[model samples]
Target: MIAAVNDETNLVEKERKIDAIRWNQAEELSTFDYFDINALLAYLVKVNIVARWTRLDDKQGREMLHRLMTSLDGKDLINKQ
Candidate 1:
């Protein structure tokens, strides 16, 4: 139905917006001279990833962003476990 198609289109658009925001945030984070944990946390919160941002250190932040990017691209690394 037309209504179902419209709903699906809206959902896809929302997902694209979220992905764009996430990638932009990741790119911005990569540009920092010295990591600002608060700024990174704020961006994650804006992208609805607050829970994942808790207690993150610099290494963890970098790893998380990498994983997010890989996942978005359908190319995540395999876990040994």
Candidate 2:
């Protein structure tokens, strides 16, 4: 997984690879603990991963990048959160 992520040249693809690795790890960790708190937490983690990808917007990302680049010349940097 590390090699796959490292081999990915596009930034978005690299991010996707990382997310996939995270999801798989979470799934593996929860595989033997059905109906337990850990399983519930892992389900939440998977849900969050899905939600994150669903909310991804290329236009918003580019706009945020532009804002960040513009702020680099200023005293304070732009904060996304």
Candidate 3:
């Protein structure tokens, strides 16, 4: 799966594919945990993964970091679509 992602020539598509893979992995890891802190942690991981790709065009890491930090304070950053 990662090999296929790496083979993608389009940079944006490659990134999106990789993010999808990461999201799937997170979901799989959290599948067994129901309503526990692991579920919450998984949710946060998924959010961060979404944020990473959603803001792919932004070259400034500092701005992205700031937005992620703000999201951590009980605010939904990007809708978990």
Error of 3 at 7 (Å): 0.8
For each candidate in turn, the TM-score is: 0.30, 0.63, 0.60
Alpha carbon deviation, residue 37, candidate 3 (Å): 3.4
**Candidate 1, position 78, lDDT:** 33
Cα lDDT tens digits, model 3, 1-81, are 999988899997887677667767766787667578877887787678756755765554345456445644543424542
Using lDDT as the measure, name the better of candidate 1 and candidate 2.
Answer: 2
Could you tell which candidate, 2 or 3, scores higher by TM-score? Answer: 2
Q: Record all residue pairs in model 1 with backbone atoms less than 3 Å apart, i.e. clashing.
A: none
Clashes of each: 0, 0, 0
Overall lDDT per candidate, in order of appearance: 0.49, 0.66, 0.67
Per-residue alpha-carbon lDDT of candidate 1 for residues 1-81, written as tens digits (9 for 90 to 100): 333344555664554455456656665665432247755664565345423442334554456566555643522323422
TM-score of 1: 0.30
Highest TM-score, which number? 2
Which one wins by TM-score: 1 or 3? 3
lDDT string for model 2 (1-81, tens) is: 698689889997888778778777876897667579977887777666666665796564555445434533434323432
Model 2: lDDT to the true structure: 0.66
Ranking by TM-score: 2, 3, 1
Higher lDDT: candidate 1 or 3?
3
Between candidates 1 and 2, the TM-score winner = 2
